[model samples]
Target chain A: MNREHDREIVRYRAPTRINHWIVAISFVLAALSGLALFHPALFPLASLFGGGPWTRILHPFIGVVMVVAFVLLAARMWRDNRIDARDRAWLRNVGDVIHNREENLPEVGRFNGGQKLLFWVLVTCVLVLLLSGLVIWRAYFSQWFPIGAIRLSAVAHALFGLILVCSIIVHIYAAIWVKGSLRAMTEGKVSYGWAWRHHRAWFREVVSARRRAD
Target chain B: MALQSLDIVRRSATTTPAPQARGAHSGQVAKLIDVTKCIGCKACQVACMEWNDLRDEVGHCSGHFDNPPDLGGQSWTIMKFAEHEHADGSLEWLIRKDGCMHCADPGCLKACPSPGAIVQYANGIVDFHEENCIGCGYCVTGCPFDVPRISKHDRKAYKCTLCSDRVAVGQEPACVKTCPTGAIVFGSKEDMHEHAAERIEDLKSRGYANAGLYDPAGVGGTHVMYVLHHADQPELYSGLPKNPVISPFVSLWKGAAKPLGLLAIAATAFAGFLHYIGIGPNRTDEHDEREAEREAQRLRAEEHP
Candidate 1:
């Protein structure tokens, strides 16, 4: 293991890490199948799921898995991801944060404003996708609805799906860009130096809470 | 079956272009329905059911003359009745045959994700190959005319094929063969247009000044045309859209939005890559490590001192 791992504090627990990966992997599968169905150009991607028919058959099932995993993951992280005055300040200084001018920005907690906003965006998109998907799910529920409503739901499903995909792209990028964030999810720990530089407020809290427990 | 293969002009989710080498002698066919002459006899509905061998569950009359209520996997055709009152205290019973329009620009074909599930013939008939259907129902949302029904039994989409099977053998559709009145006509689209014009003229002569044909240009015209007495007000005939086109939302979701969404995702990754290249990983250096160590040391000292 790297020396950084030796000097690390727990960021995500084992359950949270496992829950996050389940959501992430499910999202990737769902997005790929959804893209294959969305356009002819990407139809070849369906081959990864056995073929077009199988892709269609599996996409909604994968979505259900993703949504369930996400709910569990979100329930745990929701408190940390809540936006506050400090998060607002962090958002205002996003340019500095992006450029690694950490001293010029607010002290970030477990999640900064961008991450909090992304969390809520994902929640909203997933909910809309589930609702709209049911209405347009021809095999089961579509006959019960008016055609006009199904048409609207189709459009809404596509739009929300696209938004969720784009948001996840950014989420993945942020994890990779922030240096030690991947380890927090993968190994459930982050170096003290990493915690101090990126999430100083969270680092302080963790240290104080440890002292109190001692 | 081989001849049927030669006629397909478009196939949904198909990569290569469909066969287009057929000679110019094959005329495009059409169905003409004269709303002015219709008496809502429901014979066409009966003929369609008989020809297609579909027996939908007998449904109760749900406060409307339209039986079997709405289109379904089995019920390909229905007669819609609208009671309209003219400004001068005259009540008119307007009856329209509602089914697939067989559009030149079929939204169902455009939106369908499964290959060979929905196909358009060169003769202007859109047909569904049920065996290839995945039953995702994108076609249902894509249809501007609100056609296409997914069966509860097999979960495959169904719609008016314009009797492509019958047409393949050079016979008129069963509905046209069975209509008591000459309200339903089947011929070459060119011939049907001419017939519709004559019918419109007769309707105009009968004190219907606004009589015209309903072949909406918004869907790039349809194989099925209707000559209506109140043609100017199509919505009066049981909410037939006065100006029907594929929904703009559907268009955006299926059209430019696809490429743009892919581009947005790609651009985001590219931006992230560029940011990483420019700034490198924001790894904590020796100074950061020292500072964190010092802070921890201070916290420990304060706790124990």
Candidate 2:
């Protein structure tokens, strides 16, 4: 509990961690069910969720849940995820960052350039998916639009869905590849070394704030 | 291949070959509608409703004789009426029966993601098997003719089947059988094309020079072909798409896009896996931890000592 002895600092609060996991779980469900419906080769996956009908019925609902959870998470994390001049400098040294030469990079804040870029990409893909989903959603809004509009929306939905799934794959891989990152989400804390080495500017700000509080 | 079930030649979303035994005995059937002979009496529509047992809500007139206004889940077929004036200023009432074309390269079957939801029989009848339908309504988007309608009650797609059930028993479609003037004819595609040629000759003899058959090859020709008087201006008959083909959007979404999307997703995962193998985890060891604690201690000491 004591940061001085534990050598750990709070990286995510309990609410933030819970929100993130909800989004993650929903994304997995939605993606799998969607892919199952998207192609015939993956049709066997429909058995995992009752059958084809159930998978079709559940995917959109799961997507809606994910969108709501992601929106909440994004609202809370937007300030920290914003890209700045220092983040661009960090990106410029991405080769070093990828090779673990963190010392060569600028002082990154709460998020590095790669993470910030992915955040915006996720935002864009999610918004497109939502709009296109409404248009092709046969149960409700599709009849209101013309066939041409529906066809375009169907294509857009598939393309954006592909982008989102790919982006999330990278997101998941980065979280796992960075040794302390999973613990930050799961345990709501990261080691002082993690903060200092990866996000020194944000660490300094946190320390100053702690000093002021004391 | 039995008489009751028309053997399926193609299936939607199917990877393997379809049943092939029913080919030698019967040629592809077609229903030809002679628009010039159609009196717009809607007798065929009435026969369709009775045979299909469809009672679409008796919709009020919408300023035109075309009852029900447009096709719906219940209404499988409707007669579209268009009043046109020749350059000579004489009015001609063009009546066309609007229903499924049952394209040889059916877009509904191609865009369908569910196996056996839409099927094309050897007799060239593109049919909707509602039991297999998941109600995704992809067929509605894929239909070049905009014929399929998803029902609100059961959420299954409904369209004219070209009377596959009747054809199986060696009978013409109810509408064709009931046509008072023989405006609708059901027979082998070859016979119908020959009949349409005779009709076109007769129409030309009557000074209707532009008469031709509307068997659009863009959709590989349709099972339900039309003999239009103004074949040059087929669009004159209720916006009959001048040159209808499956929407390119549907084609890309169902065609190259599928494999490309799968490849992109797989490539992303592969890249991440390769990165991990090449670079390993970016970890902070005990030395880094000690250095970080020492710096924090120095900072606190400077502030509060």
Candidate 3:
């Protein structure tokens, strides 16, 4: 690679990238296994997880893995994702952002308004899922809850799971919609141009910090 | 289950209609339990274990005649004895033959996630296909009557099947056949209703004015009807829910939520696909690179100069 292309900046550190992938991988497994139980049409997906009983056994454990991994990643990103006045303006101009006319929008940062919204949504959903999951977990905690609570938790679990899945669909779609975004999580770096175009404020900060260090 | 292959009216977690014609044509049956006549002899409980070949471990009593305290995998049926004090202060032992009510609308089947794990026979007997059971215990949560017991051994749910094995071959349930006091009777649903009416009339004539048949319409009328002397309070007979309906939450979760949630998910993905085709990807081209390099150089010059 030429020196020009070598000017790529760090978007996510190695630890953050690894933790994000752990959450991603576990989320996929948990969602698929959960969908297997959610509807009979999706029942065949159980075979991918060693059939129904095994799917039942593994889904909650996968969810726990996802939750723990996500908690770590979220803690790392929480400061960077705090919403501010610029983020609100950026959110208001989401139409332009989606259409690739982001020049007039507020200077985007390390995490955009949309990304912050998704982050909070994920945190809320993961918390709900963990609580409701315990109540409906048949092998253990279910007996502690009364039938009414069990019923409520079972319904809540499914509903939140749907919301989480939908939110993740949007998250995955956003990652693909923006070019070079995937590499931020995959290789832990983003091209200088990609960072400048997508997150100009963060790009300027990183450049000044690099100059200061030098 | 052996005879139900050709006549399943409903199958749990199955969206497609079951083999319906034969099951609909078959006459639904019922077991009438006269709670007024039950001596709490526990013959029915022993009959259940013997017929199903389930021998629960010999456990100590919890200071009551009810052995094992409550139903277990090996014990599909049990007599629940409740002492009720009348308005006149006379104590009455309300002995209810507690087991699966086998509702016309079976909640267990509705809540089950496994295909064909729980099936309703044309004759209204709901039987569990343990082989298909995933052992998540959703049925226990779904059951308004709280009848299903999940086996610790196999993790499969077990409950009173109303002797579906015997019913398939034109024989009555073992419990119905072995009640020495003639407290339990099995027949066509219509015949059972008629029999219940006669018993109710007899009790009313004997001054039990609140006597009535407990068919419980909230669950579309259970196949297991009870002739209760104090039917005004089914709860008095060991916490029978006053009106058992499939929980609104369970109904919502398994019903509209399924299709609506799927639609939302599909729409989201499709929306993304359409955007990809329409707006295309937002790229960071040479202009962005030039801008970044110039800004970096300006910042460096400002710092050094």
What's the lDDT for all of these models? 0.86, 0.88, 0.90
lDDT-sorted candidate list, best first? 3, 2, 1
lDDT of 3: 0.90
Error of 2 at B251 (Å): 0.9
TM-score of the candidate numbered 2? 0.95
Off by over 4 Å in 1: A1-6, A50-54, A143-146, A210-214, B1-4, B23-26, B63-65, B85-91
Which number leads on TM-score? 3
- Model 1 chain B is weakest, by summed lDDT over 10 consecutive residues, at B18-27
Model 2 chain B poorest ten-residue lDDT run: B1-10
User: Per-residue alpha-carbon lDDT of model 2 for B1-305, expressed as tens digits?
Assistant: 33335378888888887776557266889999999999999999999999999989887879998998888889999999999998999999999999999999999998898888899988889999988898889999999998899888888899997877888779999999999999999999999999999999999999989999999999999999999989999988998988899999999999998989999999999998998999888998887787777887877776678
Residue-level lDDT tens digits of model 3 in B1-305: 44546788899989899876676454689999999999999999989988999999899978877786898899998888898898999998999989999999999999999999999988899899999999999999888899998999999999998999898778999999899999999999999999999999999999999999998898899999899998888899989888999999999988998999889899999999999999899988999989988887787687677
Question: Measured by C-alpha RMSD in angstroms, how accurate is candidate 2?
Answer: 2.3
Arranged by DockQ with the best first, the candidates are 3, 2, 1
Tens digits of per-residue lDDT for model 1 on B1-305? 45446757899988688776663266889999998778889999999999999899998989979998899999999899889998999999999999999999999998888878899988898999988887787887888888888887877889998898898789998889888998999999899999988888887888899999999999999998898898899999888878889888788877887778878888988988999999876778878878987887787687678
DockQ of each: 0.61, 0.71, 0.82
Candidate 1 lDDT at A164 equals 95
Best by lDDT: 3
User: TM-score for all predictions?
Assistant: 0.91, 0.95, 0.97
Give the clash count for each candidate: 0, 0, 0
